[model samples]
Target chain A: MGEFDLIARYFTRPPRPGGPTLLGVGDDCALVQPSPGHALAISSDMLVEGRHFLSTVAPDRLGHKALAVNLSDLAACGATPLAFTLALALPRADPQWLEPFSRGLLALADAHGCELIGGDTTQGPLNLCITVFGEVPLQQGRSLALLRSGARVGDDLYVSGHLGDARLALEVFRGQLSVPAAVFDAARARMETPTPRVALGQALRGVATAAADISDGLVGDLGHILRRSGVGACIEAEAALSVIAARDALDAEQALGFVLAGGDDYELVFTAPPDARAAVQAASAHSQTPVTRIGRIEADAGWRLVDAQGRALQRQDQAFDHFK
Target chain B: MGEFDLIARYFTRPPRPGGPTLLGVGDDCALVQPSPGHALAISSDMLVEGRHFLSTVAPDRLGHKALAVNLSDLAACGATPLAFTLALALPRADPQWLEPFSRGLLALADAHGCELIGGDTTQGPLNLCITVFGEVPLQQGRSLALLRSGARVGDDLYVSGHLGDARLALEVFRGQLSVPAAVFDAARARMETPTPRVALGQALRGVATAAADISDGLVGDLGHILRRSGVGACIEAEAALSVIAARDALDAEQALGFVLAGGDDYELVFTAPPDARAAVQAASAHSQTPVTRIGRIEADAGWRLVDAQGRALQRQDQAFDHFK
Candidate 1:
């Protein structure tokens, strides 16, 4: 089938009733009305075949992950999901591939109330690019944007859900490590279909001082917040190690490394003032997403890891860099 | 440089002083505010190396064309450009290529007041995907969207600027044809940097009944309007032949083929009531974009071409299909 035919059969859907979307697919452009008194949040992410995923990945999972990553960005900004566009380039149009891919994509979109707007499908190497649009209250009063630059000294740093499982799954996929079947299955789920903490982000809208999604490891991603906020951080290594799902499966050193620098967790790492600790806990409870206080923002210059006794710890791991 | 560094050096810029952009680069997501009473118009396009352009095309031109194509989609909908996000995957980080590419991209963006909001950079085979946002008035009273389905049974069909020059340039690049140096230069300019009819589209907002951008040749793209509007059209072959820049350079058959099915013109093919001829002419003059009246919409079902003597012309040339 031709490109247009393929899109019509798989990706096109009727516009859902009562939302921002005015016109959906099949037009030169999709029309959407932003929620009144809200600013639109936009983000784009691209995933290349071999670089971003293994060839053995299911098309359905790849589709989910593609949109999930972009939504993760929206979550970091504490925005409500509105809609998204997908630009997909495939080497060939196979029904087996297109069907499951669209099903996975639409399922996630429906779950988040994010509609497929408009995109182009082309014939080339496998690449999926998604641009998501969302909305956030404009009059939040005091810049409740959850900006990377908002963390102040002495704020408590918290992370939603567990970490390091996605990286553990990667290690198993690479044949670098082995684990029990149940552990492997859990890690594999985390790696393939990450749950973007959208509700938690919106719940923490005015609660978190600064926030970022853990894509390139907690230490690296939190470092971005520190640099932007012009502050330092002290991450308790023991607290971090306790949050790793595979902590018992690996040695302390390896588990610590994965917990600090392993990537693809898609959980929110946020900061809040000590005075707002109760409110932060309430947000976690409201969203039903677990939170772990693992660090504190510092007035000093760079990030440092500390043990339970407050002694500095040494580490030799780096965040994932596409070009590196 | 790493992916972030590459983006910081090339694509990132301080948010422009005044526009819809509330926040730009360096964040997980960018923020924009739509006009108070307008709906957002969104579209995306992907350019894959080898499939979309030759490796020999200048990086600068490639950058301009990448965003230009998406802008063309906005123009087709009578929307004013607002901002855009770019998702790029490159084979390697080379300053020599990025410098010119950014210059070309930002130049066009500035020309249309479109800001670079947020995007991702990755290492892979070269691919550029752009999603552009635009705005159109929500209360135009009579569907001033210029939708492809709004054409009436009796309307004058019009097209902006010249056609077939890009295809001529492609043929020259493929070594299938040759032209004078001056002619070649002009065709190359049209092929590499065809002007999107943005102003003309806005000018025709209320004047034209329906419109579409001519991307995949006149006939094929016009076929989209026909199918969407549930109507047909008959083109005056002589009038179409008159608008092709290389009409005198090739045989009648070859010239007709290019004019009918040559893609990448980036011009607008629109329809308006015969009674609105004066308003259409005024729009053309106001936008300073030359236009040609080539045919009329019909009540019947398929498109046909007639010679100066009203004799039906026969030719076989399909539009450029990515899969085919």
Candidate 2:
């Protein structure tokens, strides 16, 4: 089938029957009416082969990761996803691949309640760019957008979930690691299917002062907060490795190293006011996500990694760089 | 530099002062407040190396085309360009390439009155996607969106500008065509820098019943209008080739073929009711754009290509299809 025909058959949806929305799909442009009380949040991300993912990665996994990463960005900013448009560049029209990829994408999109409103399909090497739109209330103090520049001195730093699962998954994929099939499967799943902390982000909207998803490792990402907020952090090495210890993924020393420097975690790292520590604790228990207070922010010049004995460890700034 | 550092140095713009917008670059997602009386129009386009352009294509032109194609989609819907986000996938981080690209993109964006809000920069093999936002009045008849499905029986069909320049330019690029340096330069400009019919689209909003930008050639694209509107058309070969005839890009007979079957013209084509014909003529005259009546929509099922003498000629259903 032709590109137009394929789009019409699977993608087009009738305009939402309502007051504000006008068009949805199957038009040159999708028409939307902004809600009276909210501002529209727009973000776009592009994933390409040999860079974002390997050529041998499964199509379904690629689709899931593509959407998940974008959603994670919204999660970082405390935005609720509403709709998205995709621009797909494929080497050829392979229905078998398209079906699973679209299904995986649609499944996640449905789960998140985001409408796949519009997109474009073209011929090229595998590349997918997704632009997501979300909403945040506009009233002052009502809609607090999380920024990397909001960290306060002496505020405790926290990270959600475990780190380095995705890194391990990549190692497995590259044949640099050997493990049981189940372990391999679990690790691979973590890399392929990221869980965007959307609900956590919303819950922390008014609570956390600074936040960002860990796409490029904890140390490097936290550095953004420090540089932007004009503060520094002293992280407790043992506390950072708690997850790796519980999962038996690595020894305490190795886990600490990985958690601080591994990329593709897609977990939130945020800061709260020292007074909001009780609220942060309550949120951690209530939200059913692990939140570890790894360190305290300081009015200083650079981040410092401290051991249990309070000795600072000299470390290199190891983080993911797209160009690197 | 690392990704974070690169983003800090580039793609980081503070919120603009007193613009018709909300949120700027540097944030996780851009927040946009559409004009009070307008409905938001969105369109996206993806350009990939080896498919959309040669690897040697100037970075500036590549950036321009990435945004222009998306703007063309907005133009097709008779929307006013407002803001755009780019998702660039690059094989490597070269500051030289990025500076020129950003300059070109910002140049067009500034000229078109669009703000550079937000986007992603990722490592990949030369893939670019741009999503553009435009505004159109929501009032029913005052700001009608032109769709591909509004042609009716006896409605005149027309297209703007010459055809085949882009394809001819490609021929020259591939060393198949030997043309004068001046002509070659002109054709190359058309190929690399397409003039989207934004103004003409705005003018046609209230005057034309149906419309679309000619991207995938006349025959294939007109087929879209026919399929969606459930109508057929009879083309007067001589009349449809009139604009190209003036250009003398090809002989009258050859120009007729290119005008009907060639692709990437990025010109406006629309159908008008008989009663609205004079108004269209007047609008065209005031806008300094000629509105040619090339053919009429029919109530039948098939497109018939006919000479001025009314003799039908066999035509092939050949046009650009990404997945064909």
Whole-model Cα lDDT of every candidate shown, in order:
0.89, 0.79
Report the C-alpha lDDT of model 2 over A1-324, residue by residue, as the tens digit. Answer: 888777876566665556334777777788776666777778898887876777787878878888998898888888888888988888887888887788888889878877788888988878889998877777852345687888988798999877777777787788876667776687778788888888778778889989988888888788778887899998887777675422474555555666887788889999998799888877777667778888899898788888899999777757777866
Predicted candidate 2 versus true structure: per-residue lDDT over B1-324, tens digit per residue: 666566666566665676656767766677787766677888888887877878888889877777778788887888888888888887778888887887777788877888878888887778888899998987742346788888888888887666667767777788965677777788788778887878778888878888888888887777778877999999888787675622454566656666777676777778888888888887677667666888889999768888889899788757788888
Clashing pairs in 2: none
Global lDDT of model 1: 0.89
lDDT of 1 by residue, A49-165 (tens): 877788899989988999898899999999999999999999998999999999888899999999998898999999999999998888842224668889999999999988999
Q: TM-scores for chain B, in order?
A: 0.97, 0.92
Task: Evaluate model 2: give its TM-score.
Answer: 0.93
**What TM-score, to 2 decimal places, does chain A of model 1 have?**
0.97
Pairs clashing within candidate 1: none
